[model samples]
Target: MSKILDAFLNENLQNLRDQGLYNEIDAVEGANGPVITINGKQLINLSSNNYLGLATNEELKQVAKDAIDRYGVGAGAVRTINGTMDLHVKLEEKLAEFKGTEAAISYQSGFNCNMAAISAVMDKNDAILSDQLNHASIIDGCRLSKAKIIAYNHSDMEDLRAKAKEAKESGLYNKIMVITDGVFSMDGDIAKLPEIVEIAKEFDLITYVDDAHGSGVTGKGKGTVKHFGLEKEIDFQIGTLSKAIGVVGGYVAGKKNLIDWLKVRSRPFLFSTAVTPGDVAAITRALQMIMDSTELHDKLWENGDYLKAGLKKLGFNIGASETPITPCIIGDEKLTQTFSRRLVEEGVYAKAIVFPTVPKGTGRVRNMPIASHTKEMLDNALAIYEKVGKELGVI
Candidate 1:
């Protein structure tokens, strides 16, 4: 390696460590579920995106096994080049039905989904009005599009309206789109989609919503667009099969024309190999499960409310989360890291989230309570939180 590159890497590494901003990743010893094993120690897991605990569901596992036996391991090639299997077609059809859209298109992963979808539509001649706190994938996608990105304050409807009006009246761009996450993962707040739709209509801007975190947890498992009854109003609905769907892939559901265009124009779909048959089979089954009943969704909410109440009663600053995601706010970065470490030492696996993922000085330990987490598990985790909070002076 060059000396200059080595020096740059070393200096930045030291800086992050000194500031308590560097993340230390721990490997899970087994399947990521309500409980996890790290370094041979069992801990109640509150750090997963598995909101419905479907990742370990027996029925889905069996479905995936059967698919692998029938279709072999891989998709064999890219979608346009002979990788599009019968299972892939079926998954897309199921996605369209689930999202109540005319058609849908799947991608390798959620990150690639945004990277492909955003750049495929918008360009230097267009503009995108994005929320300040959208996921990093959306930010990168907007950048890749080469579109002029106008950011509005997080969920401030008036700010969005003002910006939309300004961008529209200026007429500097040929097309304009307003994009946001259906549920902001960091703060667990639902987007103001109703108000945003109203603004979009007033300005004649295209609407895009990435409901990665809201798919299995909101709107009776349909998602945030349905939560606000804007299914027909929104132009683009993007989602992940990885998180709530308990599989690995991403998709864009919309009118037939949008899907048709993406099939030809989206770079990821055109270039990348399709998802494996096993994952697709399992994803389709999981979507059906979510559509069939609200048992898992209801249980997830119950656990979320239970954990939030426990944290609040213990005097921890659990932020204003509308979904099953709970974030215990600890202002200082070092202290927040220490709080999380102490929790792990006491057998509760909640991870600290700091700068870059969130703003400086507003560090937190984000918790995800899922349906598979029993009352006993939550009570024990709460006890551990109390001990850690008192010891660390966080409460």
Candidate 2:
């Protein structure tokens, strides 16, 4: 308890409180599915990234339990050591097959995958053209790479092309890489990967797409690259096993050479412990199921459409979302927070997102429609939204 440290923390925390920026975390009492219990209250969940509802699937849970029985609970060590178990290998193989790539490499988490893969390939002598709306992980990875990061307008091809041309013609860097999220999570807009691929070719830039939010939600569960039929064109395809796959890990799918390079050079893979055998097994099975049938994917999209249509009909400003993610915009930050609080009080579990996460004055309550959410649940949620929106003068 240093006095100086205490004063600093107290000051910043008070500042956050005054600004209505401090987020209070709510714990779910049970499994976080379509409906979740929090603080002894049951509510329809609209704040999860579990696009396909595989996170609580009985089959995936059973597979994980079976794996635990066979291989124990832990990975024992890092991947470069004794931790590269059979399950891990199989999961990587399945990921490669799922992404239509030659090979794939797994990491402990999606954040680690970005931090490891980006810095491993690009160095200080390189320049990274990043999407202005890319994920925090991508931004941190680019920073770690020591590369000059040039941000282009969100999904703006012209901006990207101009930056790429300038970076190339300047000859100030040895290699240039273009990195982006396949699906911009906040807005739920799909990236223009086809145009980006063409630009990459025109400027000889290494293309990297982090498809964490896209897997199992787009391209019939293949991803944005596959959705656009440019699987072979992108140099790096990064994804998470946690989001739609219903497990916990991340991976990079690409050519054999890229996989080999990551295996040898990625510091996180070399230092951090590998994902558990159970997680690896469950993720592999999830991928298999996604590839086997499009039932969950279709259901997810159906629910998304239903929710979006309902919100629009109710007259909420549900921004330009191209996917299952829906955002009910409330321009003022305080009103946005109040709107989310009202929704929770009325049995909806959507969270309010404000500045820093999004631009100032564009605060919103983001809703994620999952495959497990039933018609009744969506209808009830919509009823609640209508009530809250009208009460708050939002509709």
Score residue 286 of candidate 1 by CA lDDT: 99
TM-score of each: 0.99, 0.99
- In candidate 2 the C-alpha lDDT for residue 218 amounts to 93
lDDT of each: 0.95, 0.94
Candidate 1 global lDDT: 0.95
For candidate 1, lDDT tens digit of each residue in 1-395? Answer: 99999999999999999999999999999999999999999999999999999999999999999999999899999999899999999999999999999999999999998999999999999999999999999999999999999999999999998998899889899999999999999989999999999999999999999999999889999999999888899999999999988889999999999999999999999998999999999999999999999999999999999999999999998888999899999989999999999999999999999998999999999999999999999999999999989988887
Q: What value does the lDDT take at residue 164 in candidate 1?
A: 89
> Can you tell me which runs of candidate 2 are displaced by over 4 Å?
none
